[model samples]
Target: MIATFGGGCFWCTEVIFQHTKGVKEVLPGYMGGQRENPTYEQVCSGATGHVEVIQIDFDESQVSFQDLLEVFFKTHDPTTLNRQGADVGTQYRSVVFYHDDKQKQEAEAFIQALEEAKVYDSPIVTAVEPAVTFWEAEDYHHDYFNQNPQNQFCQVVIAPKLQKFLKLYQQ
Candidate 1:
């Protein structure tokens, strides 16, 4: 199964899915954009209409889409618009790019359930849309937290988020 999500920086989203038990591949990419084959620099300019995303291929037998949605809501602040932590701009918007009708329905139901449950202190503003062109980010963006743990963003932001995920959903 395929699950694409955009929640703030692709670096952090990619890292989180990579550690999930059933995930087969977590690729950093750009989606929901107008530009064709947008480059990292171009998307960063905030003109391409693309949001940084992670395309995850996972084993459905091992993990459900609902489970992934749970993790997604927990890891990022969905209340904020076009931002996650220090990452800002429309490129950092929270979104789920569903690959099929079933996925789309599930995503919508999940969002509704979260709202009814009051999962967040504020309203959840995650966007659920049909899957579009997924342009993989430049190779340097992959596994960024693993490769650059010493970086200030990794140490102060990504690391704590990863730790929280592990504590909440240990394999």
Candidate 2:
């Protein structure tokens, strides 16, 4: 099944999902935007209404959507509006662009449950919206963490998230 999530940088989400057992592929892209074929720079400008998202293809039999949801909610600060870490702007806003009614319902219910449980100290601001056209980012963005392990951003920001994910879910 396909799941598209906009949770801060696609770089971070892309790396985490790539390490997931059942995730067949994680493609970095722009979603929840009105612009067609938006470039990374345009999305970064936060004027195109695009969010940096990763469109994931996962095998539900191996890793349930619930598992993915758990990881997504836990790894990032969903309470923060239009930001994740130092990355701030509309493009970094938390969102789940569901492809179908089931996905929409599931995402909504997940957020509801989290709210009820008081999972975060603050309210969950993650938006659950219908999936829109996914414009795949440039080829250089694909597998960015793998390719740019030595990058400062990858080392300082993404590495820690990867470690935490491996500890919590990959155990």
Candidate 3:
């Protein structure tokens, strides 16, 4: 099964899903954009209407979609619009590109449950959109955190975030 989520940087999201047990492969890509074959630079400019997302191919029998949703919600800020930490832009917006009606219903229900439970201080702004073209990111962007561990952004932003996710999800 495939699941697509955009919650802040693709690098950050990629790290979270890559560590997940049932996730077979996670591809960092851009979606919900107008342009075809959008480049990282173009998406960063926030002009292509694309959001940095991960196209996750997971084993549903091993990990349910709801479990993946739990990770998705807990890993990033869904309340803030088009922003996460120091990264701010439309390309960084929170979204779920559902592939089918079932995913759409589940996502909506999950958000409703969160709202009812008062998960965040503010209203959730995560967009639930139909899955669209997934333009894979440039070759260099793949496995970025592992490849660029010494990079300042990875050290300052991603490392700590990944640590928190590990602590929360690791058994």
Candidate maximizing lDDT: 3
Question: Per-residue lDDT tens digits of candidate 1, residues 40-147?
Answer: 999989999999999999999999998898888888888999999878899999998999998899989988998999877889889999999999999899899999
**lDDT tens digits, residue span 86-148, model 3:** 899999999999999999999999999999999899999999999999999998889899999
Cα deviation of 114 in candidate 2 (Å)? 0.8
List candidate 3 segments past 4 Å from native. none
Looking at candidate 2, the ten consecutive residues that score lowest on lDDT are 162-171
User: For all the candidates, what are their Cα RMSDs to the real structure?
Assistant: 0.9, 0.8, 0.6
The lDDT per prediction is 0.91, 0.92, 0.95
The C-alpha TM-scores of every prediction are 0.97, 0.97, 0.98
Instruction: Work out how many backbone clashes candidate 2 has.
Output: 0
Candidate 1 ranges beyond 4 A from true positions: none
lDDT, candidate 2, 1-171, per-residue tens: 999888999999999999988999999999887889999999999899999999999999998887888888887899999999999999999998988898888899999999999878999999999988999999999999999999999999999999989998755
